[model samples]
Target: MTQTVPQTTAGADDIQEIVERILSAAALPPIVQAGHPALRQRAAEFDGQLSRDQLDRLIGIMRQVMHEAPGVGLAAPQLGIPLQLAVLEDQFDVDPEAAALRNRSPLEFLAILNPRYAPLGTGRASFYEGCLSLNGLQAVVARPESVLLEYLTPDGAAEQREFVGWQARIVQHETDHLNGVLYIDRAQLRSLSSNAEYAAHWAEAGISKAREGLGFDAGPAGISLD
Candidate 1:
């Protein structure tokens, strides 16, 4: 399935009520796990579905949840809201050596509303990815190395942007959440591992050992693990 989510419209008042109800239910909403119906349903797009204050609050809360989870990106479906909204940020906390190896750099915080993306080229890269909702498991998932993204800013201005390397992967991952897809759905089943197993058996070798031992091919792509 593609990450093409159809736009949806809801009265601002109605959306405000919904947001308020959900917020009141939890000061910090829990990340909905993999099997939740909300995670399985396609999210409704944002079309002025929030008043300025409500939108601000929602974005603030989303950012808090994302940061607290220590995740690079998070989508509304992960919060059980089923809305096409997401927040992404990365500090490139890794050492310069690792950052360069991953083609990673710092990213400012961004809230993407009703976002979509297209691969920039045929190039792809594979890496282990874990989700806040899935907790404690990681799997090798291959994704486009670069992507062109279209999204609405918090103020509803439409924008197009390009992201590369690790940032591109983050964009694809969160966007997939809005479309009711998880990384595991596109992962190499043989490469699945618990956090402990990954650290104990594959962390030092990067993905090369996992690929060779697990018998999955990452194909020719961006970052070389050889």
Candidate 2:
């Protein structure tokens, strides 16, 4: 589970040095942590050059890596590939109240290419969120509760879909990567906490309790987070 986030941006020479250092790991693509150039630069629409078979293989590998991270969703930029693609799924069998409270539910694995989204309604919600690239951390991110989206399937068939609750949040999160935005960029910094701390102390407390305890609503003149 250990990974490194390069402290400084790399130059062409630095990239060569990095490549030489990890030459043995050419096959298994590493999930690039935050601070890498790819995670910051907006991704491009997928070039249709890769044949369907090649695209399938690429998607397969990405799926395997995503599952290994044990994350519900992942984007192409996370793997250092600047393409508009992402995959995600969730199980509805988690605690009912918890799932309902957090707007999470079962969802079949889905892949999205060249995705775009617009608000579905005026509803907004806030819940703690995490990212694979920004591992070990969680924070409260406020986003629209639902969205209308357009994206391509793996086969390049265009489609429109509507999503609500946690599903919408996941979609927004992944698509944000394609636009060079991380949850942290929109997160309530006061709510930041280690995943372990969140699970141990905040998970069952409910969002309001969690927010109060984490100083999420504390203004500049309010209670100290520490």
Candidate 3:
């Protein structure tokens, strides 16, 4: 389901109070849409602004919003916060078929700050990707099969790690938000489909079939789409 910020005119403090209430009680914040000014601009680095305890609280709030939105990942821009932060947790239990077909396994909750990534090798892959900011639609986006990511953990520790398969895709997708990029910007528009249409037409089809169906060429073995 889609959510929107309230339409009524209100002051900043009023909005802040509402957001606090939602966090303290039982409501999910409205996810900002694609054309929202915040989503288009590059996110600011999360310098040592908020205290450690404050960062911890923000993480908790973001995780809650991510789970409540029922999305695998969410970025700060999606909530109108222009900071380089994101949260992700790939829960595969509900759609085991899609998960297995997509080579996506369950992932523990992860929070990354000021993230950046580079392709690990020359290999590439394509897969249907969706964004909370661009709700209801999924598109085929070509991305590197493996990537080396550099980022600061929520606790401010620097980390450098390599990820392959679906994990790599997740990192690429989230980190792109730091630069104000969306999957759709790199996706095959002809392969676009609404979420329901995606389930109907390509959910069970292997990556090759979907690629062929959408007129895209598939890559070699390890970097295989599926």
Best by the lDDT measure: 1
- Write down the TM-score of every candidate: 0.88, 0.81, 0.80
Q: Model 1 — TM-score against the truth?
A: 0.88
Stretches of model 3 off by over 4 angstroms after superposition: 1-26, 94-101, 218-226
**Over 4 Å off, model 2:** 1-27, 218-226
Instruction: Give the top-scoring candidate (TM-score).
Output: 1
Query: Model 1, 124-175: lDDT tens per residue?
Result: 8888889999999998888889999999998879999999998998998898
Each candidate: RMSD: 4.8, 7.3, 7.3
Error of 1 at 136 (Å): 0.6
lDDT of each: 0.81, 0.74, 0.73
- Model 2 reaches what TM-score against the true structure? 0.81
Clashing pairs in 3: none
- Cα lDDT tens digits, model 2, 108-201, are 8899998998988788888778888988998888788999989999987999999999899989889878877788877788888898998888
lDDT (Cα, 0-100) at 86 in candidate 3: 88
Cα distance off (Å), candidate 3, residue 185: 0.7
